[model samples]
Target: MNRRLFPLFAAALALTVAASPASAAAPADAYADEVVAYRAEKWQSAHFDDAEKAQKHAATLKKLGCEVKTGAHGGHTDVSHRCPEWREISLKTHEKAHQWEDWLKANGFETRHAH
Candidate 1:
């Protein structure tokens, strides 16, 4: 291959990868808004090998409404904060949703289709 064409080919490959949808998504958007099961948030890292340091981290987490617990670490105890993860709420079936809509109308609440 010609040296000039080699550079152009590499540039095209790079552009292709960058333009892909997967590469375009941001970190927070990685977890889609799709409905999913309810699960506890996994323990996030505090970078502490000492229980005392971890306790301090846990204190901060607790202040922000996280439930924390400590587990066995190699040299000490590992503290991890358990935060609640948001679960998308949706009525799966249109029949059930319509039932609720009817009930809402009977109760004097206005309900309509999403469209």
Candidate 2:
């Protein structure tokens, strides 16, 4: 390579690397962000009286583009879902979870805090 062209070659290489697909991909915290959103939504702390109800709730969350996991916790069913793409949705879900938890408690269903 000509010494006179070295700077130009370096600049081109830098631009190519900066614009590469790998560089443009989501940050390493992409999944972590989802988790954070899920927690902020309070979906992970929701409690149900039975597995069936928990599964149903999980299904509803799934329809909203969240991945849910339901299981028994402290003798009650717990439901948790992954983050949605929008923060607004997460906030909405959080409010919904609060209402659901309150209703469950009122209905004589035991509830537990998230782990």
Candidate 3:
């Protein structure tokens, strides 16, 4: 951890990230679309920082003709949308976010959600 080599390490990391195929494959909008699809199919849910963002995401789902259901409280901030077709793969009473993806995949759907 020499101070003089910090810049070199950062530059290398930057270059590595820049050259990643995942970074070049799809734009944010495309990923957003995938997330939207997952939500539509009830494969996942999203939690935004504010009500506005939640509503906005809900609006996107609506625009796509999704039938989103908000909590009984009427979307104060935390909204959970359910897809009737959703079949739970498995339930993890306590698991980290990283592990959830694989668990979900093994269950059935191939999806990811935005946090």
The TM-scores, one per candidate, come to 0.33, 0.36, 0.31
Candidate 1: list runs displaced more than 4 Å. 1-40, 45-47, 85-115
User: Candidate 3: worst 10 consecutive residues by lDDT?
Assistant: 30-39
Writing each residue's lDDT as its tens digit, candidate 2 over 7-97 gives: 3323332332111112234332221211111212334446776666566555544543455777796888877664423321111233333
Clashing pairs in 2: none
Model 1: per-residue lDDT, tens digit, 1-115?
A: 1222323323332332111112223222232222212223565444455566556545533433456776765776665555444322123345533443443233222334331
* lDDT score, candidate 1: 0.38
How far in Å is the alpha carbon of 52 misplaced in model 3?
0.6
Worst 10 residues of 2 by lDDT: 30-39
Local distance difference test, each candidate = 0.38, 0.39, 0.36
On lDDT, the candidate that comes out on top is 2
Relative to the true structure, candidate 3 has a C-alpha RMSD (angstroms) of: 14.7
Residue 87 displacement in candidate 3 (angstroms) = 19
Candidate 3 structure quality by residue, lDDT tens digits, 4-115:
3324333332332111112233333221221211223453455445566566555533432346655434435544454434222111122322333433343233444344
Please estimate how well model 2 matches the true structure, expressed as its whole-model Cα lDDT: 0.39
Comparing 2 and 3 on TM-score, the stronger one: 2
Error of 3 at 54 (Å): 0.7
